[model samples]
Target: MNLYPFQKISFLLVITSTICLLYIPRSLGAEDDEQYLNCSASFQCANIPNIGYPFWGSSRPNYCGFPEFKLNCTGEAPVISFQDKDYRVLDINQSASTLRIARTDYWNNVCPVSPGNTTIEVNHVEYASDVQELLLFYDCPPLNIPLPIQLTSQFNCSINSTANYINYFVTQNLTNSGLTNISSTFGTCNTTVTALVSQSASENLAMNSTKDNLVAVLDSGFGLKWDASNNLCKQCNGTGGQCGYNTSTAEFTCYCKDGPNPSNCAGKKKEIAIGLAVGGAILFGIFIGFYIYSFIQRKKKKLAALAQSKEIPTPLTSKSVATPSTNLSQSQSIPSYPSFTSKSDYDKGSTYFGVQVFSYTELEEATENFNPAKELGDGGFGTVYYGKLQDGRVVAVKRLYENNFKRVEQFMNEVEILTRLEHRNLVKLYGCTSRRSRELLLVYEYIPNGTVADHLHGKRVESGFLSWPVRLSIAIETADALAFLHRNDVIHRDVKTNNILIDNDFCVKVADFGLSRLFPNDVTHVSTAPQGTPGYVDPEYYQCYQLTDKSDVYSFGVVLIELISSLQAVDTNRHRHDINLANMAINKIQNHLVNELVDPLLEFETNHVVRGMATAVAELAFRCLQQERDMRPTMDEVLDGLRAIQNEDLGSEDGQAVVLDIRADDVGLLRNMPPPLSPDSAGTDKLVSSSTPPSSF
Candidate 1:
């Protein structure tokens, strides 16, 4: 056909566009499939004889598997730096998408140069639920007092220990029930390491604690689940093709005998056909639209030139040649206001993670200008005030201190962490003002009743409203909330009776996230300056400056102690040696002087059931108060222990046993035991006031 210039240009443009679009995808797909033959061969090491897909090594290319899943087959078994740490892969279950791996440095020896926790940094990798952590304490000073049975399982790691220092290994199931009056004798350790082992293996090692047993556990390794390209791999295999990753495109690709396919081998030809057809149709439409636009622009210019030649500008001015100001004047003359729509009345509200964002004025009015009468209580970072929101909902507004750098950090940290977390026992976050507001304020659901501290020893102590059942319920709920927080990787650094709020209905609400921290997934603990309530702080955390969820366990231990004794955590009026409640608790429980610590109001002398429950709880508290963080049970363990003590069904299908040793009748037999050594004669009455034997609840 004899076509004009525009037609010829349009034809060439359509052909070029179609060619580039159709050729690029095909070329890329061809390049990606180059490794099809190479990846078809499975990876093999000495023990792991056959592994494929999502794990490439040695002879395999990068496109064969995920970058993070690459293995180093140079050694006897497959070695992979799964999460920035070298691990020896013992076996792989392709069907289950799991791996059995052991730490390389601790293969034979229990000591490592820079021992670290096994952390899963990649999204695809996760420790199986059946994995349990084993703790190793190294280079601890020999105690002047005899070591407790929990710490007696000593292994001499000469590399990390010396004549003056020794090493010890303990499992997660170990408790501090055997600890004597040795709280003062607990010494600091140089290095603490955490290792993972299968739950079955850990339970099996519960009775045996020799060095060889621990080394064998490390050699056996634990489990990990890999979910890389799960669906894609299934689809690829179903279509009789091999599944692989395309590093260039950062996507899953299917490899067939013919070539690489975007999805599956069976659809390769169909996909290419569709791509070409769609590209051609799109290019033809674009070509037609461009031609029409060019013609119109060209015709307008020609008409303007002809009008100028005829010296007639009226039609051009009236129809098309309007000045910028003239156009603006016409728009202004339109009836905009009469039919104008409003912008849906924004109440100056915003949302963060589904948490409402309030204005400064609204919060100020809700708090009645933060009146002193509205003051609720003081907190780690700010003061809380009772307020009612504009929506007629009661709330507790936390007004932080003036705009300091730390204040801003805490404000943001609380908002970010609280908004994402949802637990029935946890205090609900309603909203907060913007970071750029006149002042930073956080609004929470109002918990009308006072804190647990108020009932224990503060304003509400005389009421004796906290009975044995109520106290036990509080402990379970608090542990539950803390466990939920730990599961979500949150550590409530300041855990005390004061931080435990009691609503009007007596439900426990754990507040105060200012001192809480979002623990890093890569480490067992975070190394930071210890900041917690004085009597409730973890002694190990304070000494070593390492914070972990176990620190919360230690603090909760003090809270448990408070519930049983109704004694303040810090009582200066008592014996000088009994200043800190945790220290007094350790001494009394170890010396069989529990009779001295029980609150008289709990009726330890008459109620045998309450006595038994109290003693069992005391034992659990002692384990939590262990000088070593590893000796303390996890929050989940604490919850399980409490549930077991209360004889309540925990709703767990496995029905995990409580590790604590409780002796209900052992409480009243302390009459023959000698009195606790008192350093101050004047405080003797205060220490020995309660003669009723402490019992288990």
Candidate 2:
């Protein structure tokens, strides 16, 4: 203990160094535990590589990833199980957070006749949006001829060729109409399985005619996305620790050198506590210094104020002056209204529509100042332009003409109608922009495929001849949309082929609600001046000046005729007796000459079953086109009739019994009723002479 001052200081430093050195190994051991938890070594499979976190197998331990995402490498390829059903792992992209998986049973077998019928259900994974569904029809009866559907491949199941059935696959989503047609036409067949397939594979199935190609497409599975959120596992990985779930405790445990903990590491707690204590002490010291400085500055300010108060000022006398005249020149211009700069300002006029009010500048930039190259088409209301927003969303912008006073009313009407309606078959309303300089604009979902008219008339370059099944499905979907609108007390006054839009997948989306009117539940009809395409307009409404849901039925009836004949509603080049399609359709159907009226493009001459279905559809159209409103069926009834026709049996070679009555109640009425005069020849005079006008709106 007896030593110099320098010797004593050296002794204290040595003791401190020894204590620090003793704590270093514990820290290093903790780091080693964190590394053990990672298990980041790449797990090489047949072709897949670097399969780590969120997936564990092979050399990776169970504690390295989520329990549900465990992979098994027992087979030639790595496999994963979802809902107890095994799926072969085709590809794993960690950067994209996606997994390509296919059912093991379907992958191994060419014709999954005895499939497990199990659907993969991943808790934290979602099927990709591009996944296409395949409907497998089994045990279908032998056909005399090939049907209109795109038949992929067929197999004979039995030794007797007459007893054997065929299997067909089409690259289209199974709709209610499709199901009904399958049930009706192939009464003996059953849809055994519905499976998800990749978009590329779906396209291959659609384009290629070879049966072997389809087998390969089915083997390559669909894609799925992992739902990984910013959670404890990510945090643990960021802090150089391994993330694992403790199934017994139902909690996330971070693996460290010492042991598993609820957080990243155990030693970090002591380090954080020490840092906080030091920070708090430093903050307290600064607060004291600031208080003392403020006190001194306040004293100095008081001293200066007292010194300034000692000075004084002298008084001055007033002088008389002449006031200027109140009157001024009237040449000054009035101030103009300010332009809108934000959404709040734009929203003042868009409250009724209840949609996003995009700024004019934003849309201008999106459409490159409405370049002519971007113009999609022109209509009665406005010109539509295809625009790509800054956020990478494609939109259809309808720019209305500013001079037409009626255009404003139509614009507001469309906005109001679309805002209140939401359905899969209806086009989505994005937003609109209203400004003094620019034309009134309405934005909508951009449908790449053109209208039904383009496809039917062979005007679209990308589209081919629409098959009979597709045409029937379009009719059903359109009818469904109309029924939905009618149920909501909304009448689509203008129902035409041009308004029925299709998507890339050929799904129907009814658009153009400019003339749509909302009918009240308390009222029987909406009385207004007739406003619709010439041939499609209801004759009763035209003469009596009364609009009703039946008017829409009449218009839709004209569209149905168009679908059947593939002819313009009002073709002047047509024969004088067949000028108006609705009139011609009614006459041909009443006289049981549906074959003459069917579209030659449909190739119905050989297929008797399809020809019969076409005839039934024509009859339905005739009912919808009745002269009297009361005689015509409701949209719901029309939909039911279409569905019934689609579900009708296509008589077998064995001569099975057929049930083909569309509606039981309408049979007698439809048979005995006399034919109404042609809409063109009868004119307004005939309609007024026969019936009384309905009540006004």
Candidate 3:
């Protein structure tokens, strides 16, 4: 294997040149690196500070953001213009890809410089499901027919002249018996304007159709969801890259620390080749070989150091990767629980799935020594208490009822699952107590309003606040969360209205993951004893002891029926043969009695739109309630069906257009079930028997 010195030197020079060329190209791109840093930097406006990617302006360059997401920060609030029309950005929820914006021209005034229909680009952004349209007819003639008292409101306005004209504003798609031949009357107005408001605002306008209320609703603004770079940004950021847009290409670009790439930072990028002239000198080639060997050794040491000191948090797995749980033997005694209130205790304590490890004493002080008045709610696993941490953050603390092995397992299971799952509709877990703590405790972001159950039939039902639109939103949000869980190989064994918490804006926050199971990817279903809220438990799971994603769907079906009917899932006061709400809904839908099942407040009969949507929802619920798990649609399908129904209802051009073509015969064809059980002594025992899963929190 002897080689001449010249030949050996030639091979070394070639190898060194290749290595240097590889490093030089990545390091030479100073302009690309600067753009990456610029895009990575977050900005501050008057109020909405720390605004980051997908939105750039002022201090940030064009390459830092998408063209449509540019912001003008010189105003009182962040302003984003679409099609030359300016909108005041009230709020931005980056996680949800949603923003609250109000029309600048019509913020506080009924009249604007130029009245036109509100336009939005469907490709860039779209209105939220809960948003509705309102039509404002201005400068109308003295009407021969009076405006509907319920659907329209008339007010006097003086525009350009001393003469006064009657102005009317009507809620679109909410036509009732009170309004007839309204289009011709609206055509008589000189100026017509269309505006969008939230569904709750539209409902309030329907209740008291006044000029002042309409003005207030218009001032509040509506929610819009941006879709231009949501998926692209996720792909870029997932690979340790800064998300940006190439203005020249008009396409998304991923900016790595090294340089710019098309998809992600780690993706193989285009390389540039450099040619080197051969050098016959032996000393130069020998020096290059030594440099290459030293560089390799240094890189190995650097990687080894990083592996030991750095802990990368992953959303797909448990925190055992960071601080593994100790396996205790039956013969071993319980370790001494420490008072984790001091800084030293915290420094020594282990993290729970990359989340904070709270102290028993600190949580006790936060909840006022576990006062009964501070209690928010209770579940099968534990009771939740409303608390304010020392740092002044309002939180809901769940205290496990027992310190048994099963309770500990559930506590660890929840912390592992919740810390890995992130969604706007799912409840946020702030932290939890260690396994050695006196009692298991979980802290979550506090939701002030109440559960969906409270609004439907519990304490808040008398207020009649949960509108049909809000209920539909709740169902869609819950289904979305469940679908996300399924995608992540998890199942929400407990799905019920009581677990669906609502905030002031009627946004859903699904809680209670104690009964959830992290399903194995290799298996179709997990075999375990059925455990969940009685009325919401899947009948097939109870019978076969096989838990699948469809179990969540079955539970959600009961939730949907409850939303439309406003009936409790399990009502002993109801007919014994129809004790279960699912059973009652099936009997009603099968017998073509959906009108009887729907709540009167939803205007199921008066409002054709409501009738169409409710009937369609009832049919979907029937499909979800199929006894065979194989027949029921997946949670993803359920979410899509609900969204389609909502979009159709909101997309109605005319107020009278039916959202769906569902008929009585169509309902009959969807499912064929046995007749309702007779209300006899035998049936009563069967309805409320031991075989029925016991009802729990």
Candidate 4:
């Protein structure tokens, strides 16, 4: 091992085909910049921005990139992949400003020796794409967890035409925990991973090898970036902060940035005092207390009327839902409480969870004396206000607007509903206040991510589109929440992605239970007025007014369709013949033209997931759209089916042995697909309005 000989051997690592591939640079380090830009554009080779280190380009180093960084274009739909680990390639995430990739189970069920490392042991990854960027996604596994690893080192770009179809792969001995961000939506086995390119010769020869393992490439966002000398998020002269924009509501709050307080932002609301007397005159021992007390009471009355007028022109009035027949008195009519509770005090103090009543004066200050700027969103029961609590917590406060007996019933129902429910995916109700508004006021934890509808359609956000797999995961998680609701005998009369709010990690929470109903014992169902979105509304409910758990099922089916197509529930364009999504999907399917109904974003996806989505969603939408009240799957059954669809296995080795079909009698409204179309009638189906169908229909 002489120094001269060692240097020669080191040079050989690049030339050797078995391991290292020598990369030349166009600018400086050939081995670092160009290697990871192979998958920036199409599955084929394209002009990518060559950037980064430890990965060189195949072409010129300075002008374009280096040679080692050059990626190969394999198959008809050419795919960009790593030179050393051809099993993986770059996955472009347009929103996160980075690239992402999963490990390949190249040695499927064949490992010679186990890597004792418990963490995710991905030693080296190939950095090559048709395009280039400096962002990446990497969450390596720990070495301690023993994986049930198997090896079959088969790799060749030309071997599989649809190599990208294999999204998940198996590392035989790796525990479930070793898989970063592992979700139940995709199969649980480490075996769910797939390689970007295929290799036949390696697989054939590895059969007799004593030890074999698949070392795949991963293109996390950072792989597309170059070494930063300073900082990436640096501002020109001012400090930097996380992105945020909410002009529609004229409200925006970004993350903390550098300044006098490098880690805090501007916002404040005074706290309300606790358990203090309503009126006190200790300082007026001899100063004619009568005049002072009268003046204060008159001023208080005027202020009360003024605040109510600012937010609502009419006096505060609501029915006490607990006694649906009896309406509650307006706040103006209630006996006046003392002024001991101040707005400034409570604004700085955190509001307690589970039923904290805020005095009228305190609420006025929190909402800027009912300033128009504080409004959030309003609905059937009341208006919601986005306010800062005394404790410095941001909260959404729903103020009940009751003037009649029915409104009172609804108010009571909301209180009972919030108290009885608790789940990770449900909004948390902090204490409520009967004295704040006409009837009651409910405060909830603020979700920064906003509603699912905001991401899919809002014009303010940029990183909102959902990747295929991510959409599947969202579908499954939402189904789980609905399942919980059904299990507790609650019927979510209105369900839509708009009602589903998301969190930082993309967790889903169903909101706005304004129309929700509790299923009573001995009563299988109840009759109610028509509710829900126009297109998503159940035809049966409109006809007979009979509402059941299936009402929720129908609404969820519409959500599924919306997610897959990224289309609105209501498509009123005259160009589209005024056909709604339900009719559009049915017609397209009947014509055997499923492409017209599915999303275009999934054009590159392999396996049944892409093509199969139309069929699955169509079927669900069809069942939920049934014109008969007695026909349709229950929320429980729909949830199960949706979950199964979410965790579907694309690879040959993934599915568990079981049939998840709803039973013959159990299959209600969704029992059949679009009515069998006649050959001559397939071209088009007449569109119908939702109001055309009734419950008895």
Instruction: Give each model's whole-structure lDDT.
Output: 0.73, 0.67, 0.73, 0.46
Stretches of candidate 2 off by over 4 Å are 1-302, 305-354, 403-414, 434-439, 655-697
lDDT for position 20 in model 4: 16
- Clash counts per candidate, in order, are 10, 0, 0, 127
Q: Which digits, one per residue and each the tens of the lDDT, describe model 1 over residues 62-162?
A: 78887778888887888988536899988899989999999999999887777766655454677677877676777877755343444426888655557
lDDT of 2 by residue, 229-310 (tens): 3266666667766666554433456765545666675445555456556655655565565567667767766765775687
Ranking by lDDT: 3, 1, 2, 4
Best by TM-score: 1
CA error at residue 174 for candidate 1, angstroms: 27
563: Cα error in model 4, Å: 0.4
| Model 1 local distance difference test score | 0.73
Q: Of models 2 and 4, which has the larger lDDT?
A: 2
Model 3 global lDDT (CA atoms, 0 to 1): 0.73
Model 4, position 102: C-alpha lDDT score: 30
- The ten-residue window of minimal lDDT in model 3 covers 685-694
TM-scores of the models, in the order given: 0.47, 0.45, 0.45, 0.43
